[model samples]
Target chain A: MAVLFGGVACLALAGGVGVIASRRPVHSVLALLLVLGSLAVDYLLLDAQFIAVLQLIIYAGAIVVLFVFVIMLLHARSGEVARVPAVLPPAAAIPVCAVFGLMLLVVLTGAAIAPAAVGPAFGTVQEVGRALFSRFLLPFEAASIVLLIGMIGAVVLGKRLPPSPPDAGRPAEGPGEGRSKRRVELR
Target chain B: MSTADLVLVGPELVLTIAAVVVLLQDAWATGGVLEPQTPRPAAVWGSLAAVGLALVWDVGGRRWGPAFGGMYVRDQFTMIADLAALAAAGLGILLSSAYLPRVRLPAGEYHALLLLATVGAMVMAASGSLITLFLGLEILSFSLYVLAAIARRSRRSLEAGLKYLLLGAFATAFFAYGIALIFGATGSIDLREIGAARPSRLLGAGIALLTVGLAFEGALVPFHAWAPDVYEGAPLPVTAFMSVVAKVGAFAGLLRVFPLALAHLAGVWGPMLAAIAVVTMILGNLAALFQTNLKRLLAYSGIAHAGYLMIGVAAGGPAGTWSVLFYLLVYVAMNLGAFGVLLLLARQGMEADRVEDLAGLSGRAPWAAAALVLFLVSLAGLPLTAGFIAKLYLFRAALGAHQPVPALVGVLTSVVSVYYYLRVASAALSGGAPQAVAVLRNRLVGAALVLATAGVLWLGLFPAGFTAAVQQAARQAAAAVR
Candidate 1:
């Protein structure tokens, strides 16, 4: 069990390092996918099977795909220089990882953890449903409102601008000058 | 879900419904918000009416509880903060109606989105559960992101929106991670339970990260890079709305959580917050000294005020908490009023943003020039305006709570800020050549300034009644502590 945990942890760390270090946005997105996937695996190992599956389905599948779609939509030029070096020397990474591992050890061991706090029924859909509908009902409903507002705002921003005189659009192409001009025109 | 929950959430529910009504009405209205034939006043009226309705539910009142299984609460602080948030939203709508057409933004959608943001802020003011707080914060954030760019034709507007979206999402992620860690530590999301939980290193780290997220929303230094540009680039009314509403919402939530439940761990977070307050004040004021544009100057001033408000948060008690609320009332009025005066000065051909535009203001428009001076003096925290009394009470609270250094910094920074604020005021005094064209004076905006000016003097000159009322509210909010 310990060996499997160590392997998964190493993979997760490596995936994280790839995310920031990658030169391409697409590669960074893929790195994010890897890290998220490894995190799901970690969740499964901890027996929060529902969270593990949800994390994979929601974050790895849906969110990452959405990110890819947005990147494509923007048509941003590719292959920008990496802001930081692609990778650090093993000497540096090793000590940083050691410090991180030490912090984890302290958090995991210094705090008391209850052994077998729940049974196999834990993390089931029905259990989550019960909790959501009962104790967490207000927040659950509030989340819906947040999502609804986000949808409306997205539409407001994304909708096609109403057709105006062709000459009106040309001068407004550059933002800084357009801003001052529009500021006055909005009168 | 339950009647009690309904009662606790009644104000936010009304605001949300009003938002939807405004949006639907916008779609149904003829010609849309900008066309010459379209009547765009419904959304603005509806938004204001909604604020009035919400205030009717709890105006000058107080209630307390762990609503919805400890997910929400109502108290004096919530009442004070919610009223302030609603007032800011109402004023924004009033100020935007005439300005929107001048800028060619669709009136209906802009008002609807502004209402939605208000709902979010109201939620933030009352949230007792961490989940609810996150949702509330996001609702406010998403709406503002769109509103910042509502003037879609402007490159700067779009850039401001995009920058806000990116930086805001980054801040939200930090906040979410902090929530996750906090959940891990307490094994529960109930704020009271989390407070009762032990002070683990994990919880401490979680709180520090959470403060960073909230700090960004409040525009504290280091997290405030977005303010100057975004404020200058976005529409003046939108900038005014954001500066007032966002600070009210974010600081209200910060006060609710940190001072009430997390006070036990003050040893962990207090000093860190105090350090943040000092740096934020110094940087914000010093930077304001160099600004050439009035919008950018006010943005920096907003940042400095955030720092002063934080002094109360660092103090962490009933006196400190209520003092912050009083100061927010003062801030909402003065900040928006300053922008209101600017909005009136806007011309069909010029934005009136440059410092030189105000140079001959006294000669060009005496009333506006006077109003501008009133707002600037108040902003400078001089006596005879609410800003002075606000500073007085705020720093005193900080001192009463034993945070002497931050309070002292607040005093010094106000002194530094006076130099720049006065420079703007002097433009009105210099009375340069008279304007070629008459200044545009939208009645609604003019009324907003007059009202704000009245509020500033009333609060400063005769603060006794309002102070007592807020003190009563603060005393009730303290019940959450035990």
Candidate 2:
């Protein structure tokens, strides 16, 4: 069990590192998808099925797909620079991960983990559901509202552009035609 | 569910309702006018009305705590901070009125989001429970995510919004993980419970992570990469609002949550915060020195100011909390006034964000130039401006707690910040070239400036009333400590 848990954690860490280090935007996004999926698996390993499912549904399925679609739509010419400039990426990323790793280490070292109870107990779907519908109801509702807002926002901001002008249907043959086409397009 | 609970949360409810109404109004205004009608400034009026209602609620009460099943609380400190946040929102609306119309961005959603964000900040300040805190933080952050990219046609705006969203979600995850740890440690999410509980290892780790999350939101160094891009990309007024009001909410949350739950673990977290404060201040100021863009410079300045405010948090005492409240109030006033000028100068469809954009501003627009001077001086912590007194008091409080390192870093950053602050001032004062046609011609904006400038000058010169109110609020916050 420990080995399984540790392997899942290692896979998550590697996936995350790949997401950060990958040179291609598409590859980085794919890596992110993996990392997010790995996180859900980790949640399952920890016995939090509800959280694992929510993680899959919300982050991995919805958000990552949206990211990929946007990346595809906003694609540059095939060989264009896909990575952010140095001092920009590392300056933002390294400290965040370092602090996260250190903090996780602290939490793990400090926490005296409860010995595994072999039966279904805490962190099960039933326990999570009970908590969600009762003690955590308010936060759950609040989160739902937040998610709703995010959905509405995405729709509003991501309005697809209308079909291009009729003039755009035809290619300009040369500079003179292009100038006339531009003028026609402006009108 | 008595009326008193509702009354205690009157300001928050009023602002929330106003946000909804404003959003509805915006939808109505722009929905039927299919041909992109001239921007009807519904956002501006709604923002003003919302702020007015918030002020009424703020002035209506000066009492404290556990008002609604321990969800919300209100006191003098919160009252003052709420007023400041609302006032900043109001100015932001006024500035955006003049600013957005030029760019032809829709205004209603913008205004509604601003009000909701303010409500979130105020709620955060009044939060007595973890549920309220989380709700308030999400409200503030989500609204900001949209507002940061209101000019969606601009690539910079889209990029800023995306970056803020990514980092913000990451920060929220950290916050949630910390909350989970704390719940595991104490079996309760109430701030009062967390405060009274002793420093178990789980709780300590929770506090550390929570601090990190809040620090990131607050834009302290090492966690502040998103700030410059977002601030520079956002509308000048929205950027100003993000810098000031959002910081108010974040600090209020930190001030209340930290001292209450983690005071016993100060040995663990205090030095961590102090180091963060130092790095944030120095990095913010040093980075600002090389910026040619006015908005980017102010973004860095905002970061430095955040570091200064963190001094009070590092102190981890009642006095420290009071000083933070006072500084936030002053900061709101000064930053709003500064952005007012930027809004004034920002020509439509032009990058009015660069330092060169301000060349000879004084010769062309004396009133705006003077307002800019006042704001710049205050930002530099010059005497007779509110920032100076706020810093003095905050440093004194930190020293009182024997945390001199943050104070020292704060002073050094303050000195370093003076150069950039004055460079902008001198740019405005140079009067070599004719300024672009000024955009801030509206009387409402003028009124905002008058009010904000008065608050800055008055708070700097005579902060007794503000400080006294803050002290009372600090007392109430500490009441939950035991």
Candidate 3:
């Protein structure tokens, strides 16, 4: 069991590196899938079958598909790398990452773990569902609200503005207005 | 889900229903596509009515205690936070009523999102568990992100939204990891249970990370890089609403976690927080001095106010908790009033955001100028205004807790803040070139200004009644934790 866990963890780590190292957007997405898939396998190995399935169905299946679709729609090419300047140059980024990695390693390694005794039904669907409806009901309801807001926000931010009526009497051409107009013309 | 639990969440339910109804009404009105130049008054009025109903439910309802299996509590702390959030929402809607149509923003989404955000803040204040707290924070942050970018026709607004979203997501990640670490250390996610658990280094680290998240939302220094630009870029009413609502939520969460939940660990986190408060107060004030934009200036001022509120949290007693609550209530008035003045001065799709925009304002519009001066002085913690009383309570709380340095820093920072606050006030009062800036003569905005000015004066002059009530509430809240 330990060997399997170790092998899957290494696979996940390798996939994670590929996710950042891949030059092509689509290839990067494929690397993300590999990472997510290995994480799901790790969850399964831990006896969290429901969560493992969810990890695959949600992150690997749906979200990755969405990412690929967006990449395709945007027609992202390998040569058309990020035109925006990097927020942190490699000189700054590398040392920052290294320090954060070191701190996390120290914190995790220094912590003493005393695993709690679990019931026979731990990680089972019934137990999870019961807890969700009873003890965690408020959080479950609140999560729905968060999801609802996400949907509303997507529509509000993404929807194309309808053409302005001639008599709208808008005084100035704002920055977003001009860009959106150009998009409409291009379409 | 018993009726009792439903009653406890009555205000949130009303606002949620109202948000959906407003969205549906907008969809029906516009035939599923946003129509440019259309002003939807129904959405605005409906949202205002919902906020009023929530306020009524929040204040008048007698049901108060742990509900939803102790996931939520409807105690005095929640009530104070709810009042601040609801007050901000009501005033925000009033401020938006005129500005929305002028800016060509869809009224339905704007009001709907604002209501939901208020619900989020209330949820955070009421949360008895970390899960509810994180969920509530997400709801609030998500709603504000879209609201910030709702002015899609403005590039600056979009940029502000993107920056806020990226940085806010990073902060949220920190917050979630902190929760995980806390659960790992304590073996429970419930606040009361965690408080009873033994403190460890892991818990300390978790608390620090949690503070980072809340401080980011509060716009405390070192985590406040996004504030000035976001405030300057977003629509005026949004800047106004978020300035108060975010602080109300963040500080309330801080109050709950530091003073109420982890009261036993005050020795661990208090001094660290005090140091943060000192730095935030000094840096926020110094930054405000250089900002020529009204929105950016107010943003820095908001950060400084967060530092003062933090003094109360670091103090960690009934005095500290209630002082923070009182300051939030007062902030709803003074901060929103300052932004409301700017909102009124906005003209034909252009924001009068510059300090120079208010030139000769006392000569042209005496009432608005006077109102602006009153809000500014109150914000500067001057005498005869709510800001002074609020700051006094915070400083007293800090000193009562025997943390003299933060209190002293707060006092000195107020002196430094006066220069910038008075600079804007002087700009409005001084006679200068005839500015083309016209104050929008909207009755709704006028009504909001009147309400805010009255609140500032009432809280300042006769702070006795409110302070007494807050004291009682604070005592009850502390009793619950103990």
Candidate 4:
């Protein structure tokens, strides 16, 4: 079981790196989706089914969709100025790979020892609901507040502007209208 | 669940109700009625009521208790922190009362978002477990993403919002993974359970990853890149909200997790934090010297302050926790006052955040200049200001824990920081002719300055009373983790 989980983690990490490195925006989004999905699977294997589902729903489905939509809206296609110039790519790649290598090394060397037993934990929907509403009530309330604020912001941003101050009740004046009218009368 | 628990959450409930009402009002009052041109006093009043209720709940709930099983806990710490956040939001609203009319942002949604974000910060301060922590973080982050870009017409605001959102989401991913791994190791998501569990290699790695993620959210070290850009890009009041309230929430969460959940792996995480602290302080201060943009400079200043706060985290005992809590209190006042001044100084489309723009401020707006000087001096950790007492308490805490290295580094950094703080103050008092620039003198703005300045001075002068309060909060905070 430990070995299998390790394999899954490895796969997720590799996929995540690939996604981050990919030049194609669509491909990158798909890769991110895979990473999130794979992580959910890993979470389930770790006996956190609820969080797994959340990862899938919130990250893979919602966030990724937002990313794709925004990318499309902006028309930021891949392969157009996709890759950085020579100086920057190597500079970026080297440190990234080093960090990746270090993380992998830490995982490989670190103890992956399986615990003696896995309990019949609160891995079910009912248990999660109980946990969320009871012990996690403050955060639950906070989440509601967050959603409320997001809605309010959407409304505020979406609201159309009011017309300009009723034109301050001033008579319409064209460019140099007053001076021109006086000059015309004198003429 | 006691009736008191319900009361403890009363402020949030009120805010929640107001949010719904505002949403309904928006739904009905479409186009012109709810538009920026038509300012709705009713909506504004509703938001004020919500803020008032949140404050009432914050003050009303003085004791600690578990709610919803053990997922959420409320205590003096939560109350104090929530009060701080609510106060900042309230002042932000007051600042915006005048600022919005001048900038043409007469929409009520601004107040609603501000209240909602405060709610998130409150939850974050009170969270007891990983699940609760993540939820609170998301609540804060998502709202901020929108708030950062509230001025949709400005390209800079849009760009900043996008950068913050993308980076923030990425950080969240890292955080979620850390949570998953910790669950895998302990088979429990509760912080106390994780705190009591013996350390394993997997758990240590998980702790490290979690620290990294939290540090980024806290705007610490290498992960701090987004703060300045986002702070600079966002609107003045929004920037003020983010600077103070966000830092408080993040630190609250960090104090809960690092010292409690991963206490066993301190050897692994502690040294890394200390290194990050050294680097963040040096880099943040050095970078501030070169910035011409006042907002960007404040952003760097914030980074440096984050480093100082992390020293308290490094201390990690009772003294350290209390010291951190105390510093955070001081931080809220000093930062909010600074941002309040910026809000006043900045006219529509003209960001007075540039360092040079502040020249001759002492002559133009003496009261505003005086307030700025107080805040800047406090930030510099000068004697007779809250910043000095805050740092003194922090160092005492570090020394108490026998963590001489970080304490020493902190003192050195504080010394280096004095120069930049003084530079800003000196500029505010110097060269530009008084007649040349128009000083901001809006009544609402003047009110904000008075409130912020009083808080900073009060905290600086009467730190003992505040420290006592923080001590009680620190005890509860540490206990929640344990």
Candidate 4 ranges with C-alpha deviation above 4 Å: A1-90, A115-187, B1-4, B23-35, B38-44, B263-267, B432-436, B480-482
Which residue pairs of candidate 4 clash? A134-B68, A134-B69, A135-B68, A135-B69, A135-B70, A135-B71, A135-B72, A136-B71
Isolated chain B TM-score per model: 0.96, 0.96, 0.99, 0.94
Worst 10 residues of 2 chain A by lDDT: A172-181
lDDT by candidate, in order shown = 0.80, 0.77, 0.86, 0.74
Point out where model 2 deviates above 4 Å. A1-101, A111-141, A161-187, B1-4, B32-37, B435-440
Which pairs clash (backbone N, Cα, C closer than 3 Å) in model 2?
Answer: B195-B260, B195-B261
- Residue B172 deviation, candidate 4, in Å? 0.8
lDDT tens per residue, model 3, B372-466: 99999999999989999999999999999999999999999999999999999999999683456776688999999999999999999999998
What's the residue-level lDDT of B200 in candidate 1?
A: 86
TM-score of chain A of each: 0.68, 0.62, 0.79, 0.62
Q: Return the clash pairs for model 1, or none.
A: A175-B155, A175-B156, A185-B102, A186-B102, A186-B103, A187-B102, A187-B103
Candidate 1 structure quality by residue, lDDT tens digits, B228-252: 8888778878999999999998998
Model 4 Cα displacement at B347 (Å)? Answer: 5.1
| Per-residue C-alpha lDDT of model 3 across residues A85-181, encoded as one tens digit per residue | 4245888689658846764775687668688777777778998999999888889989999999999999888887655533555563222232233
Ranking by DockQ: 3, 1, 4, 2
Query: Candidate 3: where is the Cα deviation over 4 Å?
Result: A76-111, A163-169, A172-187
lDDT of 4 at A179: 11
Total clashing pairs in model 4: 8
